[model samples]
Target: MLARSIIFLLLSLSACPLFAQQKYIMTVRGKVKADAIGRTLAHEHIVTNFIGAATVVDVPGDDSVVIAKILPQLLRLKGQGINTLIECTPNFIGRNPALLKKLSELSDLNIVTNTGLYSAVDKKYLPPYAFTENAAGIASRWEAEWTNGIGGTGIRPGFIKLGAGSSALDSIEAKMLAAAILLSRKSLLPIAIHSGSGQAAISAFEQLKKSNWKPEKLIWVHAQNGTDEERAMLANEGVWISLDGVSEKSWEQYAGMILFLKKRNMLHRLLISHDDGWAVLENGSYNKLDLFENGNSIPYSTLFTKLLPALKKAGVTESEIDMILRNNTGDCFSF
Candidate 1:
């Protein structure tokens, strides 16, 4: 047993980067640590609006109203011991480095931001240039966001995000995905994909594999909505499965899948996130807007009060939760 353990350790060490180091912009008191990883909501739009890049002329609100709306939620998340959040807001709307920096300073929450283009449900809503933009153009912008920082603040993004159309991967979206993979490989950044229902997760992975991208470098988000067989396949490839439940109807629906992965010793690569945001008021307005008006109301408190407790009740150990939240998240963006 001792010899076997030693061999395993050696192999693990060999797989890790030779000059492994903990790289992060800011750190919190109790939560941020190089070794910390558990219960990370691998899929969450920390600050985002439903309309996204589209003009929301109907939404009655300015920047201040949005920030005020989401402040409480950020405060709540801070209190919840949710060490880190991989905010999957792409460059155009969701990338707010200054505001994120302020939130980290004020809330002490580790907000890992992402870079890349968004794949909207409706192509008609996308930017006029987005449809005609070639893969190289998208990739150049993505690379700029990572190296030079979004909008020239020099605040580098932590990960790359790619999404398909609400229904399937369209030609333009596929080009964007391929471009994202190319840029991510060059920058050594991990890629996260929005796999909306059906075999989206599997298809995305298949595309990545075809591009010769390693599975470990990709995170297939919304695994909770995927079929059992698809989830199992992702687990086998050592891909991270984000079993987001916040927006999903029932968190319990994912419990079985979580248990299955755990039983199969695949829990290390799993993540759980709420994917929820500010409440939609009766008048059809969203509260909790951030600096860029892309904010949500699902504060840290929600994670601690509702989400964490629910998972605990579902038999998730604190250590395991830490792995999902802290360790796995850190690993995802180690590049």
Candidate 2:
């Protein structure tokens, strides 16, 4: 049956005169055709950086430290059939593009890196420079990175990211968001906002509207906490509504969200993931990383191991499943 399916796909594709002009996912290494991106985790952190983290927590040091902790998880994600993953850890708070390139090379799976700043955690996460920079100045920073490369690593970003504070965007967070919209307008890469709650998510959406940016270009991350009406409204506007609730505690909730999307006929705009990441191992050393939960990053295997079966049991069809895990995610990355 598989052989027949492959042959049928080949025959169908060969019949299309415009097949070669098809767009594909933009990865750290290069472009990838859609078919090659088998299944994707839309909002995951293969490697998370937590610099200036409040309280006491482990923050991985240099590239070696991060690679030592995250490479195994990348390979494990590949083993579990996740062909592509998006690393949403933004700048300052430990966004490492070079490490992402290396991991992609070693694991032979497509890993995408992002540009922009994160401000959801606290004002401290916002760099000192962010405080003084105007919106255009901040945008120029991201634009330069996108045009050239971030930190001289020569690794360009695949998407724009912003972390809006809970309930609203503070002054600096709002500036970063403005930069995100401007970047999207210039580069056509979609923007993902780590919104804190329903009100904050809606406020960001209103800002996007005010800026005349297409609603489709906005992705409201962490929107799972929003009311059903709010989520549906955003989904109705064609924005990507990401419900990244993939852990032992939230797996059932994740499945329920999928069922909700299916019922509302909004699965095409839905993005799902563990939102989990490999821990920033203490001291850049890998002495048995029992700290996977230390950084809110569960194993990459959570989606494939725990959630897939539950989604199936919840009456999600194979085609719908493929659309959520692969197609929607691939669409999210198509630059």
Top TM-score prediction, candidate number = 2
TM-score of each: 0.78, 0.85
Give the per-residue Cα lDDT of candidate 1 at 50: 44
List lDDT for all candidates, in order.
Answer: 0.65, 0.78
- The model with the greatest lDDT is 2
Off by over 4 Å in 1: 1-39, 52-67, 166-168, 247-249, 279-303, 306-314
RMSD of 1: 6.5
Q: Write the per-residue lDDT of candidate 2 for residues 1-335, one digit (tens) a residue.
A: 99999999988887797655565666788778866788888887765545453432334444665577678878878887888888888776557677779889989988888888778776656776788988899899999988888878788888988888777777777788898898889888889999879888888888889999988888889878787778888999888999885787778877877787788999899888877765444433334334446223447666776788888888888898899888888777676
| Count of clashes in candidate 1 | 28
TM-score for model 2? 0.85
Evaluated at residue 153, the lDDT of candidate 1 is 62
